[model samples]
Target chain A: MSSKIRIEDARRFRVGDGFRLSDVDPTATPGFSGSDKDLKKELVQHDEEIGVLQEKLHAEKQNSLLIIAQGMDTSGKGGLIKRLLDPMSPLGYRVQPFGRPTEEEAAHDFLWRVERALPKPGEVVCFDRSHYEDVLVQKVDALAPAEEIERRYGAIVEFEQQLAERNIMLIKVMLHISKDFQKENLRDRLQNPEKLWKFDPSDLNARAEWDEYMDAYQIALERTSTETAPWYCIPGDNKDYARAVVKHLVVDALRTIDPQYPTPDFDPKAELATLESMD
Target chain B: MSSKIRIEDARRFRVGDGFRLSDVDPTATPGFSGSDKDLKKELVQHDEEIGVLQEKLHAEKQNSLLIIAQGMDTSGKGGLIKRLLDPMSPLGYRVQPFGRPTEEEAAHDFLWRVERALPKPGEVVCFDRSHYEDVLVQKVDALAPAEEIERRYGAIVEFEQQLAERNIMLIKVMLHISKDFQKENLRDRLQNPEKLWKFDPSDLNARAEWDEYMDAYQIALERTSTETAPWYCIPGDNKDYARAVVKHLVVDALRTIDPQYPTPDFDPKAELATLESMD
Candidate 1:
């Protein structure tokens, strides 16, 4: 019955032709309706299901999954990763948080660090802030020339297509929080003693150009979201609702993968007897 | 009082100035003496301490940690990581397992991938197999010319020193197991149907050249173990003991870092009052 939750409706959040970030209300939970308690209970069930699906994926050892989380600071990327993916077996799941490029990373092409962090077969990898940073921050800040920024969008499409061809499923999510929501989150961080360490004064510089960033995200989502790797702009002002939607989407993807326990190539009865006889 | 445990003595297992892999007993627990129950309990305490230290490290947002785990097949690198590091916060730690080089990776210098995988500040990263693979497997297989192999030794020393200067603490560990122990482990894998996915026939090829691999490790350790990054040859025959030793070493390094709860730049009382006043 939970399978009937229709997570595919999340595609409604997908960027399509002429998609605008301004059109969507960050406070809207597009598909589901439940009290906070009910939503959390549902998330627990999804977690268990995801855990089981991951074990199957690990056992099958064929396909891989890559989930990319992109958003502005305080958009809840860390919270989503901690709550959703961290509970899974670390053997088969990895979380790669991309931050400021090191001098060494800067020397290489933009995608090199991203390519290096890719999931191996049967592994699920989440990118906290990913290659999208190049297009977003780099574009808004004019770190790269306009021409180069355009070129990267094409490059991302090709890179993601290659991954899909190699049996890697790609899920790109942008946590869509309103400018007002961001202000509240930033203010909360500034006013919490325990959270002060996470507060970077430089974030205000980004906030000053909020409109430019939204424009950058709009253009990026339009250009890079392809059949192989579609981008979803999840409404993130309601953190709990956003988390629920993400859980459903991930569950739906795993269900589509539907990995089964691998059949043993060798005779199981003989191996079991041998194992039994071993000292 | 547990801090009195000297994890540095793990260096007793170090491949010193004039060391031979043949000199060490793989079955021996060099610096620890405890029952399995006691070891597990101790590991739990260390895990809790590690959790606390990692929180401080994250809060401080300064120095980084890079832990390299190198071992032959069935030496329990995966097991050690799952048992020890996986329980910690995924927010501040990463596990990278390097397998055979891809065509793209092979295009770059040996250290290119290693450089890419280095930890950012306030993060702890573990490499399941690392650049040492270039020296170990590549040397044994004669994949590189003799001159190039010699050059990598110097490159590694310089590279590690640079990392040290950059404030990355490097802990290099070699899970040491005897050839006889490896045979038993391989047999166990072969006889276990559930673990068949992990059984790779190519591992047999590597096993055939065990002596050459040992020689390669000996030369590598002798060449690269410096004050900044030291190699500890952890006994792998008793998986529990190796894990305990690793836990102690990691805890000791974290204790040395001694990252404190960062002081708030703003007045906590005023901020708390402001936060309470907000809707």
Candidate 2:
């Protein structure tokens, strides 16, 4: 609630008809007019609120949340999750990061593994990378035949619609970053001994096809960003601002759900009386 | 480690020959010779070390950790987890809380669901309550045949050994709390609207058979605490002290594993060169 970005204004970042990935400036901090230091303080406040809302969500045990975070390598998906969910109780949430599928996973439909990982009632799960990859990476890399890839767009829309029907709210976020920003991040990983473990050679292959990946992402967004589970595109070059925007989206969704503590089934006075009466 | 309880002294809390449930003082804060304020500061320091070691564990991807928290109702299993794990990145950890089995879970062998929830390599999972319940609650409530309950102890020991052989380090913890402490906690939950959702009528039933459950826990600890997976009993009347001991135990295990940031498999210079040369 302390956010400078109103829920209505944050809607500007949502993917829509004719949405152009290149039109958004990754470095610009829209809606937030404060200094970085101020944003940090505001984030702490927002996290505290997220913590409370998450507890109510857990206590209600009637609905679940699935937050799908998709982006190119080094686009800050992991960083965004840490800022967004660490302040909340770990008991009420999970972070499931999808990697290149195992042999068993690759053998099934693209959504098989994803369906198994959806949040149970009263839980919030963040997907560090998700089924969106089946379309984005699968399409750009030609891992699947063109005809099969074309069919996946409708398959994904229907899959998400089923989740919405099941009372599982979906927050789909695409952390949009420029190619130059990713090169800087990859270089930082290569140069820092502490970060060297994160630098994978495969990342270079992905980087080489950045433009194609962008095109694939644009197509996926256009096809799948429906009214039920629309996608939000956050400019990720400024980690703080992007993280703040994600916090707003999660808070707004939780606010809409407005989970409340369930009313106790037994009378407290009677239960206390019975407890004391026990020998 | 900043812990006043040296790992050897902490071993004193382990169950072994002539271990008696009644002998241990649930209110004593042994090993820790600090004020509550000092313990609070020490816990923060320990959590920072946990955060760093956990990342290394994730990077290495050769080992995993399973922390099992078991205690009487209202002994602060959830609170201990919030303190011990929330400071770390949510990406690297999961909290799996086992409630009374559903129809499907009840139909399977007791360990079936737990087997499915074990941590993967490079991950840390906390079982808020776990397979130990099969022996504790099943024995107390006579949920299964006496002979069947008798078989579970051996089954559990063998199961944990399998985990240890697979490089999944297990930290089994029992939060020892006085009955009086539990009574106060339940009263607090009943009195507070915010916490009312957590108060269950069945908890009173368990409390009524306190002596029986204590006997059950003692028997389970004696039978199942092995070299591979030892149970650490922390005094729970003082929550801060209990949480600090659990943090130290986890930190010590991670230190023993001593996971390292993996060396890059590819030549970094050549990869960088190739990356730069790509069109």
**Chain A superposition TM-score per model:** 0.95, 0.96
Best by DockQ: 2
lDDT tens readout by residue for model 2, B1-279 = 233655566667888778888899999988777677787876676767788999999999999999999999999999998897866778888999999999999999999999999999999999999988999998999988999999999999999999989999999999999999998898888889899899999999999999999999999999998988888877889998888778878888999999999988888788777766764
lDDT of 2 by residue, A117-210 (tens): 9999999999999999999888989999999999999999999999998989999999999888988888888778789898898899899899
The sequence of per-residue lDDT tens digits that candidate 1 reaches over residues B57-169 is 88887887888899989999988887767556778888887989999999999999989889988988888899999999999999999999999999999999999888898
Q: Model 1 chain B: which ten-residue window has the lowest total lDDT? A: B1-10
For model 1 the local lDDT of residue B136 reads 91
- Which candidate number has the best lDDT? 2
TM-score of 1: 0.73
User: For candidate 2, what is the total of clashing residue pairs?
Assistant: 0
* Window of ten residues with lowest summed lDDT in model 2 chain A: A1-10
Question: Scoring model 1 with DockQ, what do you get?
Answer: 0.23
Q: Estimate the TM-score of every prediction.
A: 0.73, 0.96
Q: How accurate locally is residue A169 in candidate 1, as Cα lDDT from 0 to 100?
A: 93
Error of 1 at B20 (Å): 5.5
